[model samples]
Target: MLGELAEKGVRVTVEAEELLKSREADLELIVKLIGLQKPLISKEDVESLLKPPELRPVEVVPAAAFAPLAKEFSSDIRLNHTLDVTGKSRTRGEVENFISYFRNRYERLSRMLRRNGTVQTDLADVRKRLNERVRVVVLISDKKETKKGNLLFEVEDMTGSFKVVVSQSRYNEKILDKARGVILDDVVAITGKVLEPYIIAEEIEWPDLPVVREKSRSENDVATAYLSDIHFGSRYFLEKKLQSFVEWLHGRGEARELAGKVKYLVIAGDVVDGIGVYPNQEKELLVKDIHQQYAMFDDFIASLPDYIEVIAAPGNHDAVRRGEPQPALGKDLVSSDITLVGNPSSLSLEGVKHLVYHGTSIDSMISSIPGTAYAHPEKVMVEYLKRRHLSPIYGGNLIIPENIDYMVIDEPPDVFHCGHVHKNGYVQYRNTLVINSGTFQDRTDFQVKQGHVPTPALVPVYEMKHGRLRTLDFNY
Candidate 1:
């Protein structure tokens, strides 16, 4: 090996050679080391090639515009794997835990409805009274449209489940329309007269999001750029456009002024398009190997401004388990400076709580909810807020049923950030800024067939000081 390296004009230090021998360097590894074109190979060079690089803390700009703002603000950001319950439950435990979790959600929502003069009656407690009227709140477990046009719902509570009927005659067009929009696994308040073996529902009520009249904002000026679904390594990856955005972050053009004020860059999910993600995926891949795909992604991150803290989470297409609450990318895939958090993570930036989810479950909600469409993603996000859960509908999305029920949004965040539908959406729901970060990957063949024209290279910058959300387009 020494003679071979000498032939290649590369000199290996005595220490490097001793270290390699101690580590029992294989022939292939020795050949690879010799390939490193250097007149002299030092201990550090050999060590770097052999071991993973040391992780460094995210660089903080001393003269950052938000430095003073951060002093007054304290972040209780949930660190990586802080409250993860994935891979920590048995089949029976998962079933029992979720049942209990949903039941708790039901009780909490029912109490809120009760405060509004709507009394909740358990399915088992309701009895058919002849010539008497009955109105109660119930959780709808199942619903079916009858051939004669009446709506039949199988609702349940902790006690039991029962059948509720909504006749087209008693209810007006508006009420009937509402009944038709009723999705299963929703907690609702039904009102009307009670008949034999059936409680005719005159009105159906959803556990709606409460109106928040006042919203809070930071006293000092600070902002964060929201991005997701870059899908690097795919043929559709918008490399030039994304490069432009990165340049803008490092101070370029009119965006330079805004760039200086950006304290953080939050990437929600789908950082890279993995291998074998879907059928015929290889046909659209520019980088065939998953490691190479991540290498390209890491290079992109390396070009980003070190002063800006970059936080990333995984999505369905990421090289993680095909389930919600996905773990962070492997050490080889992502750089150390970037904070790799779990899917459906809760982030605290200067004490401002922001819930970041990849929005995989949004697909299920779009199909299940009537008024919802992919064109208006923020509308569906409202359902998660109303339920105070990230992915509430079980069996809709591929979620690992953990014991702690991490899907439940225990507390309202100042910002609810999600991305996955490849569209941009923003709205203020009950003082929470709900935003769906757009994608970097342009329209692919699959997306074209699905009628989705992704709004690529658009980043939503949330200004905490002003409590304002704005989108910056870099497609040009």
Candidate 2:
């Protein structure tokens, strides 16, 4: 190799030869030394020596220059380091090997930060001084009770490991006692305050709990009906029938009997005929543009009586990620009378707590579980309550948000309402009433093709009196 380098006009300095003989000359060290000795050895020459001759560097225009030579060199260094670590026997290796692995990973990550120009040395110093407060969510791996009454918890995160000590105070005792025997991998959020090199936990919280409402439920005589997934922009959208039902609400009839009673209205999801939603769907869309579709929906929602409180949530069709229990519509789209909330919002209605999730995935779940799809679609709400997830299965038809965690309601609701399959159904699970309000949209060509006929029915009314209830159907 030395004689070949000399023949190629590449000088092998005495120190470089000594380093190579000592087996301490890594690719990066060699490149750096070569560059220092001979500034004329372009990056291409170094790359050619590293690999097979067929893989030659392509010449590019000066304007379309390749990335910096230093960057390419650093990347190659990191790649070689990774390969070296991965090829070694992890079990037989000493602690030094583990340290080397970690160091390499950290250095590679640092290189990535430097490349992006996002590395802040000042911020790192500040982080060290600030005690390195890290917010980590992990499942409690194991817990040990010490003589001092402090509970030592071993926690693990995606990156690495940590520990939490809960002192034997009344508050901590209660928390630790509850945490014992928790399923391995049950996620919990822990806030760690750095105690020099180690982190001391300041607090631990359950991420699944719903936002607690501080105020007590107010006493009110007015009633509210919540429904969603109307899909108003579809050809099957029943504008005339919906108008008739609206007329019945304002006119003197069964719906009018509870006219002044209904104080609020909520539409949960799928408010529009989604763009390119299904095959041959272009012809069925009454409103093409998403913003315009929402505009039309605004007009329809506005047509309702002003006295009724309206709450609208974003559905799969709306201009948001196709996730379960999405947030309410933007303020620009709807009137002040409306309060938009997440798809699955807990509302205290006349002292009756109702948990509403626009039933998007209920059909699939129901279809999977025997007797659920045919006999009762509403019972699937009970399944969700049992699983403690709005949409437990990921990659379902609905979209879930990446960052914002879904709030879990520990306290069961008095009623649960959902609508997506466009089937009006009802069932009772323990003390909770599960209601799936049928869609306002009538049968579509898709339904006909699938040999499924949707039941066109009016909204069902419920009367709650001191935990007792009565169901009334307004089919007319």
Candidate 3:
């Protein structure tokens, strides 16, 4: 392997040489390593180059970020493994896999719709019973508007396909609103009857939760702090503001009382400014090495109050696979003191079920759904609940065709949490609290060009007892 590197005009340290020589070299991995455009390869470089690399801390994340916790609290974080895709990835990406994957999604969501007592007939059965109002569970394949201000779409089930249309002149805002939000590849129940060529829609129903829901609360007064998009290794990372945040966590600043009640901290993703995440991202990185980036993240997380049980998931920027349902960050990224789960992981904190996602697909939702924007990600998060499926548009985000569809929001969570757009937003929809806990990094050139104003270093704390949420502005 060292000889191969030599041919590529690359020099390797003695440790790197021993590490490479010790193992049966993987040619593809070596090729990727050389592709990094590094002049010298050290043991650290070799180690970091491996997928899900072995790592150790190299830089501190604002060494003065935190003071020691004045008081200790009991931790009560329980991960719901049933919905987590951590250890259960089993897809080979074969042609059959995609078929079975979407089939499973249709069936699961179909059953959820059935629970609403809306399954009146199958698509084939609907064709048999012409001119009859029969509800059929169908996955929308394509949609477009007509010249007469009507929404025309095609939907399909295992049995057959049907052309459906909803008239704008009908003035039914409820049905029109639902129809407007329907993107491609969404599973829904359409109550319409066949008229030889078209199915005139009467109502459209989603596999959403009950209109009335009971929000659960923790037994104790403990709270959980939500945050993400720390971008620790980026030049825009707000170090002094984060220092204030850590001080607040130690009951040293304003909202000291609230800080004392924070027994858990949930960070959805983007804990660090990952190397090579975007074009020319290197120029903005304070720490160029990926290992050092995570090292800084580790130090910052390690500096937090030990009693505050921390849970982290992966994001687009993190060193995880490039797709939704990203598996948990490995122990190499952070200390074992924290719990790591997959992106869009479900877990219980103090008896309150919280759905935590890195929310990379917010971009897709914003583009597909009208009135959804980066500044108001909570509105997009609500769409996820309404559809009861995260990343409903198959091609909108990169998805692994795993046998099981982990993106399905099988159960409406007490709290739906995500972070990706670097915007702070919180809203309670139908008893489900939705939160997009902004970023800790200041504005960047990309955001400036995109006209996005980020609410950096603003922390959201969810009070468990009353399902109340409040933000602490540490951006100063």
Candidate 4:
């Protein structure tokens, strides 16, 4: 009945039907909704009579005209790997795959660390040498403090695992500090002396950022605006401020001059106030139905100027799997008009490669790294780039692993855009512009309790010509 209704311009989904059923609405109420003055009588007019005013029926459009910029610069925007594969491994195979993947990561960094003059020894070899000085690279499997207050680490290699001890008395302040900051699963080079069953560490080394940076600046005058976390249908959604931005894009106010130059808009994710996304979410939602929520989002996007091509990716709140390498929302939710891609996707806007990630793993990044915090998201972005992987630690965030590590930064992007922290941050790392686009939603009760001040309605526009960034404030 819903599919038949949709065919005649009435849009309905499982979510919408459930909401409607909850009301136990009569035909008269349904007729009034579709703006029909005539009474509901004939079966032929049933679909048109029940169609809601707000739900704009989906219209198919030619994809070529506004196809994602990724198509144009396919060579530059490389999807190194993805987890969208069938026949995923069984329990034992999954464990083996995880171990093998990390082992490869360990070996790769180990070879890189070898240039630092650390004699590379396997975990098995380290066990052989008792009461002798040794240097080795290993993946930290586990770490704990003893009753004696010394940090003990169970590090492993392909050969085997060994216990590494950082004695409070023996190791100096510098070594202890590094040991304290050591993250589990992080492959590190350790220089130490072998004890009875443990290696007493002298120094710990991380695969830090490269000194020489490679930057890209476009010769073209085109610019792109980065945005995310719109959370449409939430009471906190900044409708007025966002409309002001759209007005600016349509050549209004001080931003009128920038309107012509801005050719692309990248939305990182959390595009809607998803149904049942959190506890007490219904109280916060202005639109309770998921289809209605997306309908509003679709209308909002449709209102934007056609000159600026919009590229969107899904986040945790989107109607997709809650895992890394999440696919785009279904066509039923999002029309073909938007260039929708998977989360953590890469594209190029006029020669400038952009890495668009929802940054759901930002929590993990902040917690795992000692100095990093939510307020300074770019610091975490820098850490991700330095490590050349997004969300390195597995258990921190929900992830569905594939044969290849899709999170690995095999190909570096010129512009990296992410959002989820709701705090805007921008920085340059090795020539790449790392930007946390922030949110369009106002501060909620949760944010207030957390003491997080979101930088809403501040759109970061990147001037591709000179690699310069200018922020446009629409709060006024």
List clashing residue pairs in candidate 4.
Answer: none
Query: Which residue ranges in model 2 land beyond 4 Å of their true spot?
Result: 1-218, 398-404, 464-476
Instruction: Please list the Cα RMSD from the true structure of every candidate, rounded to 1 decimal place.
Output: 16.6, 36.8, 21.3, 18.2
- Cα TM-score of candidate 3: 0.83
307-362, model 2: which lDDT tens digit per residue? 66566666666665454535566665554455566666666655566676777767
- lDDT: worst 10-residue window of model 2: 74-83
lDDT of each: 0.76, 0.55, 0.85, 0.76
Worst 10 residues of 3 by lDDT: 63-72
lDDT of 4 by residue, 275-317 (tens): 8877889999998898898998888888887656787888888
TM-score of structure candidate 4 = 0.76
| Model 1 alpha-carbon miss at residue 85, Å | 4.2
Q: What is the lDDT of residue 350 in candidate 1?
A: 63
TM-score of each: 0.77, 0.52, 0.83, 0.76
lDDT of 1: 0.76
Estimate, for each residue in 295-350, the C-alpha lDDT of model 3 and write its tens digit.
88888877787777888888899988888778898877776578998998999887
What does candidate 1's lDDT look like per residue over 66-129, in tens digits?
2223223333244525444433434353667677757666776666556666555666667735
lDDT of 3: 0.85
lDDT of 3 at 134: 78
Residue 212 alpha-carbon offset, candidate 1, angstroms: 2.4
Error of 2 at 86 (Å): 43
The better candidate by TM-score, 2 or 3, is 3
